[model samples]
Target chain A: MSRVRICRVGESQFAAALLPREAAMPEGLSTRSGRRDAARFAVYRNNVGVGLTRALERRYPVTLRLVGEDFFRAMAREYVALAPPTSPVMLAYGSQFPEFVENFPPAAGIAYLADVARLEDAMASAFHAADEACLAMDALMAIPPDQLGDVRLTAHPAARLVSSPHPVGTIYARHGQDAVSPVTHWCAETVLVTRPHIRCEMQVLPVEEAGFAAALFSDEALGPAAEQAASRGGFDFGRALLRLVSAGAFSAAVNSAEKEARHA
Target chain B: MSIAFSKRGPRLGFFEVHAENYMGEGGLPHHQLRSIAERYPLSLHGVGLSIGGEGDLDRDHLKRLRRLVERYRPASFSEHLAWSTHESAFFNDLLPLPYTPETLERVARHVAEAQDILGVRMLLENPSTYLVFEESTIDEIDFLAAVSNRTGCGLLLDVNNVVVSSINHRLDPFAYVDRFPLDKVGEIHLAGYDEVTDEAGERLLIDAHASEILPDVFDLYRHTLRRFGPLPTLIEWDNDVPEFPLLFAEAERVTAALQEAWRLQPEAAARRSAA
Candidate 1:
């Protein structure tokens, strides 16, 4: 069987046919109606484009509503053309769309739009992320007070933190519920996306609390993480910790002893 | 199985989800699917496991599918007979395959491996194609039956796809359904499609699934039920999913058709049960 050559379709050649015909259509495509035509290529292109754009819209509905249908569709089309999905799963398809929007020339006027997209993408990703059991407060309490400084908490698999210079979360929240445009009050805002129970929940964080969460996300121990939060000033550690615990943000607590051993 | 749009869920015979959607590492996908599994029967219809490609089957995808099957224990698992991956790149569309002896051997081997890894039989679905391969040596129905017989897997007869393919290929839709090996079918699918014209002005049908089921498709589905019996049917609305009422209306329409089929042909329903 190995000796006899079997006829095979050239995959790369067929894939190139699906792309916009830069030069000419790849050879040997025929419909039952008759010969190959330019319009046949459009069928494949439309399938890929429309399918991906719908996926992007699903992931970033707030961005779509903010940009309006026409502009969002045009931008999504270009993004799809440039960065076609490597994976077949649509859940992870639009990760680059936020960055694409940030640099897209036409969208320069709407600076906060990029951040809004980032928030939406984070939420969608959080929705499909792997589930992990949240770390209980009792586990954190079990750690000795002196060794607490060395304890680093792991973020839950579904937890995502997005901080932006503009009030992106508020903008996204307003647009998400309806089509009303909110007044663009320029302020920094951070949002935490996590699946506390089965529902994916989004919460806005104050600047100081954002810093504390960022520190812990960067693997800072609880003691130093709290200190960093305190340095931000006006950050009530007990209050923020209670809110985070309630949100199911932390998945596992790494005690100082394990941290020390890993470092050692 | 209820895919709830309202505060409460709609009553469905079973819930079918695209397997690729739940492949993500443990978050809401798992949570919601786990909850749904506890309540209703699940059929994991996979879109990414390209079983007809020239290359070997993706071991990583198989591993993940195995995990999902082990975790959920879905009543049925299915994939398309079409290929999606080519040379290392995933196309995101079910590209058509040329049905020949070599392709048949390849697909049969792939299906067998998939069933072995998942520890259960899987169903292969017929895909809707816009073009025909000049190298093809067998008809679509024969190709599907051959693969099913070769590997101990079942068939998922997507009725909408049969209509679309028959129209595009200029074959009689009714004749295609008549020739289908209905006994091997474990589940059935009905979806919407879009109609376009080729350069030659010939009508071309694409399985878009973005709109309501057309009368032609509904009629074809009724024909399928009468022939194949009232199998576990799924109303697939992938793109532009309508409001809950409209979606449920489609399900109700299917129920109506099933009841009609039974009323008209009691003997066929008995045959379905015996099979």
Candidate 2:
């Protein structure tokens, strides 16, 4: 016999039983026909399960394709049961999905899948992230050359960097299309996501460039950021900076001395 | 699937989106919403507020909503009367609420807080449910009317939901509309529902919003308009989104209904005054 737990009119137990299979149906949950109707509860469960699964499928299309439909559905069911969305915004619902994939025992064989999910989640975030005015080249040039060393730059809100041990970006891009070309080799890769245009764009970056970008992202002074880039070896600081700037990644830059002097 | 609103096509009113979909920092969603807002009106229909939840409202979600409202300035803002969040968990479905005095007081308080924080009047939508609460002391119409009366919120009368809920509960759809506080209706919604038979082999209707509006739902909408007059109506097609032309075709059907309602208004008024 199934256990019967009587939940209050507006309580968590009633809501909890609707999502997870393990939760006993709240006593007194009845249809016009009968009390403790399991079939009516199934409809509610289906709504929560299918709705959340569809949301995850949309946010992680690449990951879904990689795992195959049945596998993805099964995995998503487990994820939804474990960690249902805390916010109403479906776009931001799967932030923990990448981490979930990392810990899922069934997905032990696919080491790169989690990183790819991370890349997709970041890309989705960038796609819906807030808009910011690009840092203009003229504005950067107008600053005193001598004071350039003290400038701290902030990347646009839509800009994101993801470094992974696997070539996740290429794998994400190729999985969905008509004809997916096999990757020649696998190696550590870093991806830069930005929405300089209307659509979000992603590009693979060399480790040195990624490291330099990460430094700049943390509000490092330009001089030290470049030095950090140089320490990474064989990176053209000017070329990497130009690429990021041209992509409209940096939104603002302030000279620390100038700001401090103004305050003083 | 994006389409430029054409002057030559069906009379498109405005777009309604789930506010949570566009809450990210900045990107394509913002870009698209910005451009669309420039040309047409918008409505920010929220699903995350959980106004009827037992727990207190989510402050972070409220802040995000306030920011979006400030940015988008949608013509109308609305949310369901049902609760989806409880404590830290947000169930994806719009869970039903019991119509008790205590529940009513809590929902009204939440709605007032949401409106005060958002600085905009919100419209609370009626929810379609699969089951009814035996502990309920008030009717659904009375409960919604009480909430709107207390919180100074408006009603988003979803016609399909009326049809769906009434059928599942074996109530009269038209009578529910008749008892509804139509004077408080700020906008209207028409959508499709899927029909299913429950375990007892009784017919149940699910508000799926996946296809064109059923004829019976359109009739319910017509009946609602006949009583309340034409408010700003919206066509909600959330799933299995058809092509723009097909969706627009369904919208044109609504346009036809509104026109028919307009044509019959004089007769309806005549009958009302005679009675």
Candidate 3:
């Protein structure tokens, strides 16, 4: 019964449930004339399903480009059936799709298909994320060095920290473009996509930098967050901080009472 | 096509944001809408608020929507004259509804309720459906007119959609011009649709808005202008978006149409001759 409800409008459930299965439906759920109602419902079901599938295809272009139209549409059809868009704004739909592609049977051949979706999802979120005035260095500098450890800085509203076991950014980049590149990692990648202006552009970062940003986003103070990143080998702590600051990755400077007095 | 706004600093167009995108757990979407609110007027276009639902209205959704309108002070607000309901479930597309009295009264009540809460008039756009219900008792033109008369809501005539619905249903598009209440129209939409053939070679015009406006759609807009007078017109090219220059050029086409209409308005022409 739950499964039938999940099929939505495009689903021809009543047509599927012909004479052999006539007696099973609960009252108010399916009718004796179920096929007629279901057929009429399918028109909208198909339309809604098609619209959402198209939105997903737009979001994950690289995945689509690599798989070709027929294969991708088939996958999109399945994905749509599984994760239908409940929201009317097409832009915000398909957040769960990347994870779905990872387990989808036909897509088993493409091991990193899920990660490609992750990058695309993050990019969409970043593109539509709110605009904020990034915190300034001068203000941060004013705080006493000792007090900096206690104050937690807020990450930029548009910045997203994504961590994956598979190299999603590399797959998205390679598949998203007209040309393919060998540099894409089969291993995991950590990425940051920030919409400083109108468009959100993706940048893959070293694990340490990604971890640092993620920590800051969780309200961890700068000093300890840098320490966590510093623990990652080959992490240039100073350069990483500079890159984040330049990108407007921090929205506001959080100050403890001591830190506030120091700045004063 | 030539169209123009009544007065201009930045013009009256708002970022026609989908209502669902901003339903956030307190995040950037709300923040951006607030920031943009300062520079430009916004239109809270409801895509998920199924106004035509048989079920009780989603109060949770309405509460969030009310909060946004209260905070933003948007210039205009709108939703579709369609049901996105699938049985008791909901879909993301603007699902069509039969124009019965029950549906009409329900939609009007919802529109009226929405306006009362938001403390402003609302615009309800007609949807483009691939199929029609046999149970439909009222014509769509009459249905819309009745809603306008009942709720005092404005009309957002999406001309491309009018053409799409007309061609898909094999009806006359210009007839919509006659039935649509011109006095109630507040805004106009001009968008592009894709022309494709189904597997059986049957013609289908989908309101995809992926590219440029078609010539026939432009003609419909001209008729709208002729009937309604020059209103706030927008050229939407959201998908497969070209450069800003191209969009600006499309806006110029609307500007031209409006300029022609302004010149043609009899009183204005007389004043211009006097000057």
Candidate 4:
């Protein structure tokens, strides 16, 4: 038989056997002595499992700390087996881990773990998102006051808003420490993640401003977004706009007249 | 290390990075890489191309690699001879393949395609294997030589991998080096291996790359340098990486070995002067 045909036949089996923790050794593999060595095959198995688990650990350090290392490792291994990375870019791996944690039975009790994972994922995304120039605060000031309402602001590529029912921002900030401070306020929180410069910055948005920020992110004009924020009662449109602009949430500000002129 | 390289850490030979790590659209990775490239030479080493897979190459991945190559124009570009992906699932580890004429044809075609797309010659690295396939008809070194000869691609002579695989397969490391195509070697890699016992009560070496190079691996590296002359050498410590100072110390050892190798071979010096 042609060795090529045999290789084509055995490679899929070889790949299938390496994934599952309880998989049997694929046939036709042997040591130099020609023995079907399970221990020898286990090296590849260990490499795949350990390599992916370490990748998850690096991505979700906060989640690892939330649950101690042992539990986290076990959870990571299970996740790896279930959803081994589809992409070779290890940095892009584990994008679906937050959802996996949410549906996981053992982790269901910790309602905040999934949100924490989500925050970390957003932070990572922002860190690696396209490098676009942030809209200077002066650009917004340069607009005529009357034309401001018709201005549509473009969200920065690196800007991400993560809203959770749990106090996830506080949990994420308390990471990398031995003791996590108790969250005195147990309510919903919205976080804005942006990399205006080299550092990734996160801020908790006031509950009233979440709607406004969401509207702005979705490309709503200033007038409507501010109106949406005002409908929430006691919403300060000027203060919210200034805060987001200063945070480098938007990349560009174009007035309706300029947009129409460009179209013409 | 990216930070250290950017901040002008101990100046050494060229710096290499995994191509996949910098495949993101834009970010700190690109920024840091740009800074490093401006200062020193960069090598684009890919770990996820899956060049030896039985299936067709990933076009999207090849495109991304092309974009990276176009942007950086690195001093060298290379990938492993082993495969890492099968179908849609990427194993994230360099999986082994059987060496046969059919597999050889597929790999050479893949390498030629990659070179066509990348618009640059690539060096293919030998892998450290624990088990051998029953269907493999070609020796590992011969398979590498055939691929290089067929595709016109260079080889990356990893001395530590020679030590690891030779011991695992019960072959002599020096003999394996003697048989390697030194003329095609564009680069060298030295790393540490983890030793374990196999089921048949034999010693198995795992290319863990988590610590310093072993004494025996260093000896083989010296032997390789004596035969092949000095080349651009890299010390890989991907996992359990120590501080920059310690990694630089390892690079210093490679430097010392390279200088000694250059002194020992007068023809190699003459060849360099003639070039």
Task: Choose the strongest candidate by DockQ.
Answer: 4
Residues A77-196, candidate 3, lDDT per residue (tens digit)? 777665555544556778888888888898899877777777778887777776677776777778888777676878887787778888877777766666787753467788777766
Considering only N, C-alpha and C atoms within 3 Å, which residue pairs clash in candidate 1? Answer: A129-B27, A130-B25, A130-B26, A130-B27, A131-B26, A131-B27
Number of the top lDDT candidate: 4
Model 4 C-alpha lDDT per residue in residues B1-275, reported as the tens digit of each score:
33235456556878999999998878889999998898789999999999999889999999999999999999999999999999889999999999989899999999999999999999999999999988888998899999899989999998898999999988999999999986888899999999999976888899998999999999999999889888899999998999877888788888999889888987885674464
lDDT of 3 by residue, B1-275 (tens): 32333343335346667767776534456666777787677877777777776555666667878877877777788888866643444566665666778888888888888777767888988777555554466888788889989988888888998998788666789997777876677788889987765333445577777787889999988877776667767776867898766676777778888777666676643443353
Q: In model 1, what is the error at residue A154, expressed in angstroms?
A: 2.4
On TM-score, who's better, 2 or 4? 4
Ranking by lDDT: 4, 2, 1, 3
Error of 4 at A174 (Å): 1.3
Candidate 4: which stretches are off by over 4 Å? A1-9, A261-264, B1-9, B272-275
Error of 2 at B230 (Å): 2.3
Q: Which candidate, 1 or 2, has the higher DockQ?
A: 2
Q: Comparing 2 and 4 by lDDT, which wins?
A: 4
DockQ order of candidates, top first: 4, 2, 1, 3
Q: Which lDDT tens digits does candidate 2 get at residues A1-264?
A: 656453445567678687776766666567744455566667778888999999999999999989899999999999998989877877788889999999999999999999999998988888876667888778888889889878998888888889898998889878869788897779889888888877888888877798888888888998898887887778996688778887778899889989998999
How high a TM-score does candidate 1 get? 0.88
How do the predictions measure up, each by TM-score? 0.88, 0.90, 0.75, 0.95
Estimate how well candidate 3 is docked, as a DockQ score: 0.19
Worst 10 residues of 3 chain A by lDDT: A18-27
Q: Rate the local accuracy (lDDT) of all candidates.
A: 0.83, 0.84, 0.71, 0.90
